[model samples]
Target: MLKTAAGGSFIIEDTTEVMTPDQLTDEQRMIADTTRDFIQGEVLPHDEQIEKLDYELTVDLIRKAGELGLLGADVPEQYNGLELDKVSSTLINEKLAKASSFALSVGAHVGIGTLPIVYFGTEEQKQRYLPDLAIGTKIAAYCLTEPSSGSDAQGAKANAVLSDDKSYYTLSGTKQFITNAGFADVFIVYAKVEGEHFSTFIVEREMEGVSIGPEEKKMGIKGSSTCPLILEDVKVPAENLLWEVGKGHLIAFNILNIGRFKLAAGSVGAAKETIELSAEYANERTQFGRPISSFPLVAKKLAEMNVKTYLLESMVYRTAGLMDEAMREMDNSKPDAGVVAAKAIAEYAIECSINKVFSSETLDSIADEGVQIHGGYGYIQEYKIERIYRDSRINRIFEGTNEINRLLIPGTLLKRAMKGQLPLMEKAQALQSELLSMVPGRKIEGTLEQEEHLIAMAKKMFLMAGGQAVQKYQMKLEQEQEILSHLADMMIQIYAIEGAFARTKQLIEKRGEDKATIAIAMTEIAVHEAFEKIEAWAKDILATMETGDMLRTQLSILKKLGRRTPVNLIAKKRHIAEKVAYASKYVV
Candidate 1:
């Protein structure tokens, strides 16, 4: 029954089989290696030039990537693409992160900019655009964020009106912070049709009245072009409309679902790079008559960086695997595979949001630690960590602010539960009665069994808190932003811990317990850390929602459910750090 539930149903379902790093196919590895080699050979050497806003060099690099078929993982083979699974696409993004700001350019072009057409375009539109865009002959940019609207994307005031002859639509608007706008040849612009119907249109740079403003300076990712798109009476043919009229939100939001997941993958890649940089710096930099890595504080930072990176990597691939599975179930004989895949990715909106928030934050922490490990040198632009830290901050702001994403995590779950897409209500009801008569504590057995138990209890805690909130507010639960945020935190922790736990369990099963020591330690560390947060958030939410005897009863249940023997993370972290320091890379 749980297996039949939709995406983000992992909160209730048993751990579904996932594709871990160890499970990458030979072909996938080849693709990853190609991407890595491309970055090292073509992009890294130009990092300095890229930082100087050399658009020509950046475009050349993108064209080189396209020549290698790196830009078309999500595009159909008929359109000169590899038509690879979501895993391959994720791998490409992850590897590209090594290029920093250039990665933003490629990600924008392939992900949000191009995916709209891949998923929502008509045959003629695809024929006209996909080949060139897929092969990097024509670059693409997504235009959804306007001068006046961002998080409230539907509030865009861009206007598109049909011509008297009905041959074209006259569009007028300014799209702000448009990635790749300076060099992009095609723009997937969102506007209101007849000044009322929100819709999407494919506008070209060559079109009359279409121009780009001067590039804006930014804190990071300067290599990627960011300019305001100016559209003044630009004539877009009616045939260029994407999806259905008034369904622009579908194109905007669904594409963003994939964008969020891809952003997570990119974050993982960036975080891993930061860890390697920090580890190497610690190994080379001397302090107190020894390498700084020999110092406990420095080692601890390295260990935390490695642990968070591993956790994020696990979740990013897990979500990608789930989307791939869903995509695989669709009938390829139909012409709607793109639409099906978009829907599949959209189904896991909560997971995507969680991955986006967690991975971005994790990367930021790793980047910050990387700088700290570099000492005073980190504050200078000469250090790579400084750029990484600056680049990492925007991930949380874009792809939906972490705050908006936090609200959506719980908000979307409730919507799905009410729609019977996720049997959350049924589980919540069952958990209610179970909690009422539940025993105080239960013994867990075997390797990582305690963590497994904690994960299950975390889910129960979420159900309990969410059910109470729903019961109290009924239809008005959206008003309680604070409670919703707490619930989101609980769900995020549950997903992260369980993702790590499941991946480690699978690894142990394949390689035996002795060989998975680092994984086991990492899993334990992540679960315990997440469980602590979940406990604090649960108490805060319950305290605000319930009082006196009721609060006491709920708190008692939470304590019993969340109870666990403390983990000696210092020892585990030391072990993890030792391994990473020796390898000078993220081993686990």
Candidate 2:
């Protein structure tokens, strides 16, 4: 029998239930409204001051958010934290994106900086740090990237040596691009122990010889602290060592997984805000005696922005649902709870990467269109979209660059298939057999039928391209970064198509087809656009990987699978545009 949801399971199974904003409980909604109120009532009023990098003001805002229990969602209650579910935490971040730079500060502290202790700290360590960190009395920063290491984390040159009496470890390292460095009271620093084993240690800012470099003048997200931490033989107590020695990869990579997901949720929030700003601007900005929103060309941009964001929002929350489910039974008090939590979160590594890459790109593209919609005013700093445009650029680079994430999507799947943890090989084999007898243009039935069939074909397209790639390259497929990236694109599109389709179905189920008319239109547009990209990428992969009769055969199968029922995106987009324009905000 097929199992319940797991990482990358959507490729094999149909998702019947998903968590959407519509399904959020009243309490979760309240948390969001509270955060929204805080951002609007407190943060935005200080826009100029924040933009000026007012350290005290930024830290004060974070402390206020902490007082509201906003920073403690991922922390367990035993440590004087809120211990909310993933959905609630996601909502908080999403609403917090109303202030982008400040959002990054809060996200870093709540996610990467502090989650290490929440999930991996010794009980004593948690007792010493969790309460203060949770309440924002003490800010925390993550230190992993070094001057010599960026994507290649293990290449870090930082090291720590224990004293002969074993009382403390003398840590020496420079941590690059550390968020909250200026105000962080605690630092989760990584160094190779005994000059060999990469490990994590909790370092205090007040520790002797600990220093912070001047802030980096960034192009955007400037309000958030971005500085380097200088540890000149800082003495970190032996008890401050996190988890076991040499297990730092577990902490670094696992925390990055959550960081990616939270970044995804934050992108969705930013993208939505961009759409709201774009829609309102297009409606209010007049062109040639008519509102720009009345123009079909401008309306089309609004529609695309609105629809793409809808698709991303669906996926972000659904992934959150998966995460919450995975950790539902966790016993945080268990001595091995950290290991257990890490394993549970690691299971969805692929999904988290997917969410990260897609959401970041979605926000970028939407931000671009938002600027275009704003015309020349977008270039001026006075406009919110200008700041948004700049701030959005950092997301792709923040939680592992999108290129790194793209490579991970397919590479991770192949690794799992080789270990029998995933059924990729089995499905690829089955797809090849199906291609022999499968006819092109087979019609699917029910609401959103054409979109549904396209999703099925997209999955087959992935297997066809992937199966041949694996057969040819074997273990060396890792070297084919381009082909692997293409395969990852297929996986992304498949997940995205299915995400939109599932959410639309839920909308129709609850509201009836009559009421979910705009949702269907948006899903149709997103599915069509995504499938077109999938077809192009598959052909690109086939051409690059094969030749002669083999290449021709693969293309032939792709053609059969790529047949479309012809969605009228122009009409659908116009309809969507009207919906958002009327509300002057992004709607379903």
Candidate 3:
């Protein structure tokens, strides 16, 4: 869905042609600098106090962020917002990671909280609520989670019955773990009207029978509010019905797509912060009469962390670029602007889920290693990495659980194939024929040729594994959760590898190979690791799905596709660690 305007080419067709962080415009760079400066000068100073569950301080900072237009990046200028591009907001989310618990408040307010109205609200709704939301005079919270429903969103028990006079709707239900519930002035609540059709309503804090429960003790992000929103006979004006009845799922799923992408961006920022902290700590703590950073194993951990961060950051900004390009040609003046925006976001749903899973898992691994790098200090709450470690745990559960997202990946692609929107079946069929007579190896040529070839083979692996699974299970593939997850893993690796490799190729074009040495090294390392994972997953799936002669034939073809010359990863990791250890941060 994030296709380029030129012939509507998807980034997967040619990632070198897509946007990268290095391709930021002057305005984007300026906004990025402003966000960084604000985080450093204002947010960081009170980070400690902010994490103590200080609601007033959190609200005040959000208003300050509003004053700087941080909360309005996705809003239209007519609504008194900055109306920045997707990349700009991605940068804002990345920068906000440094704010710790405070980041949660701001992200919730800016993303799911406020974006519903920005995209789906009618003219009167926008005029009435947006100006205040844009400048932080009012804070909005989304109410989709119910006590009995988590991943099964459609199973919500919230019910809203229309009044006889049709003047309002009476809402009664409990929304669990609602972000910003303690202080939110407005709520984007989802309920079924007439106990049948799913829908949404805009409920106000001041309405009768509206109440906020006591904050739940949380493992992390304590500075951000987390409380249940109780709606008992709460009357919402009929005009506050969002976009019409039975279309609430549109608002819920579309907003989540955007939320997943933003979460990935924030993870990139958090990962960088972890690396910097680990590097600094490694350099200061002496062991065996030398800093711990000098050890080969510690260096290996740092390099691995840095490589994952690079891959995640590359995929994230590339996605932001895709979204911005798609948004540019839309006619927002039309009344269906909200619907148009929802469609646009839904188009890239696969990419959003990919980033969410990759970014969350990436930060989790980095955080774990971060604790190891700090030894005993990492276990203590006095250490910031400890807090980061705790905070990162929730991201996997946010937007959508990683498990649900993993299944959604291949499921979505297959749906597109059936709908004639994607040529997945055709490509897989072609790959089956190509593998029948194709030779095993290719000669390496120019810069990044190996990585590029690896990415191509990985895509073929996904197609082959997924194709065979479909042929075997057909319509029942949805029930094969393990196979689906394996297919998703391959695709996730393909996306990350292609995105990172493309960005590296772009940098090489502009700065030459010698200057892009580190980027090249990181790309190659990630590509190799990802290829191995794809290989393992393919082998497992093929073995499980086939038998006897057919299994042997499939394994033979996989061997041809997986053939490659191995590199001395140990030396490269040490080289990467040397530079990061010297700079005490992730560079390039």
How much lDDT does each candidate structure score? Answer: 0.90, 0.89, 0.89
Clashing pairs in 2: none
Question: For candidate 3, lDDT tens digit of each residue in 447-534?
Answer: 7788788888888787888899999999999999999999888888888888888889889989998999899899989999989999
Q: What value does the lDDT take at residue 145 in candidate 3?
A: 93
Candidate 2 lDDT over residue span 211-317, tens digit each? 99999999999899999999899889999999989989889999999999999989888988998999889988998999999999999998998888888899998
Residue 351 miss distance in model 1 (angstroms)? 1.1
Candidate 3: Cα lDDT at 56: 89
Give the lDDT of residue 495 in candidate 2: 88
Model 3 scores a C-alpha lDDT of: 0.89
Model 2 segments more than 4 A misplaced: 1-3, 440-442
The deviation in Å at residue 145 for candidate 1 is 0.7
RMSD score of candidate 1 (Å): 1.5
User: Given candidate 2, what's the lDDT at residue 511?
Assistant: 97
Could you arrange the candidates by lDDT from highest to lowest? 1, 2, 3
For model 2, the run of ten residues with the poorest summed lDDT: 1-10
